[model samples]
Target: MKMLAAVVVLFLAAGLSDSVILTKCGLKQQLQTSLTLPPNTTNVLAQIVCHVQLTSNFNTSAIKTINETEKPHESQGPRRGRSAKNVRPTKVTPKPHLESGEDKNEFWTLYGLFQLSDHVVCNSTQRHSLNLCGLTCNKLLDNDISDDLACVQVLINKMTAVIPDPETAKHIHKMISLIYQPECANAKASVYFADCPQP
Candidate 1:
């Protein structure tokens, strides 16, 4: 009985060892240092902090599986011969089965503190990934978040480019304002980290 108890304790310790629950202040400091924003960008850092807090709650080992089904294109109509009653759903092969032993069809997975997607941003054992970040998905789950921040910068740059107005494109805070409710705008970035210990 004692031997079994020792094994259980060790197993729990090993699982906990890989994950780091970061303090809000720690996360803020890391973001300030790691992310490269444009000159005079305001509240963008806080917006990121709010986003991360909502997404993963500062847990380094956070992961979420999204079951995404392929949507039919707007231009494509229903099949010519198949009626609604005759149509059947086809099962697609699961992509990128993780080494961690989850056998379900994980269409897309959000990983780590920032919840970066394995489908386009990071590579995994799963096939048919765009791998825009050119790094492994496992890297995002570790305590070191510099790589994750670098990828975020890439995504931000891409997003800003899509905006027609040059002034709005210069800052991501404007983008956040458009997406989130007015009450939850960049002004509330500090609110997300209010619980953190102050210096």
Candidate 2:
């Protein structure tokens, strides 16, 4: 009974602490390569469930979309002739493709970035009590900026092959820079972003 109470208290405390502000879906879309998942919810729930998901909308779609987006493998057939040319079938070669590996789980990576930035803002002990938030943004000038750059590189390499749009791509890139840039005293990164409604 005591343990259960402890866990519940921890849950609410964490939730309130990690309160969300802005969620950059466009930025995630950029890093995630605009691999659209099934449209399934309202803006309210988006923060709670955003990075919380394990599977990616991309990988799920890949099984279906790959054929259309990717080039078909060359068909192999048995060579016909006599002894020397003895009819062995050639193996088909699949086209080389980009793999997101874990990056496909856009939310997980973003959440991780947020968690790291949170360290810079709140004391290490306070890190435990954080809520499920959407923004999961970073607001450090130098350090978070470095992380954002790394994330951008990951997404550019992973998602570009899928999205293939320059303008949307640029928009996402810009947002990533915005996410990591520092704000005032920095009580929490999300608070600053969530304060004003997203334009």
Top candidate on TM-score is 1
CA deviation > 4 Å runs, candidate 2 = 1-163, 179-199
TM-score of each: 0.60, 0.17
* lDDT (tens digit, per residue) of candidate 2 on 1-199: 9999999999997765533232344334333343333344223123311221211121111111112211111122322332211222232333343355833421111223222222112222323312112123333112223343353344334333454666545434433332332211122324322433454
Error of 1 at 186 (Å): 4.3
Please list all clashing residue pairs in model 2, or write none if there are none.
Answer: 14-129, 14-130, 14-131, 15-131, 18-130, 18-131
As a whole number from 0 to 100, the lDDT of residue 9 in candidate 2 is: 100
Angstrom error at residue 146, model 2: 20
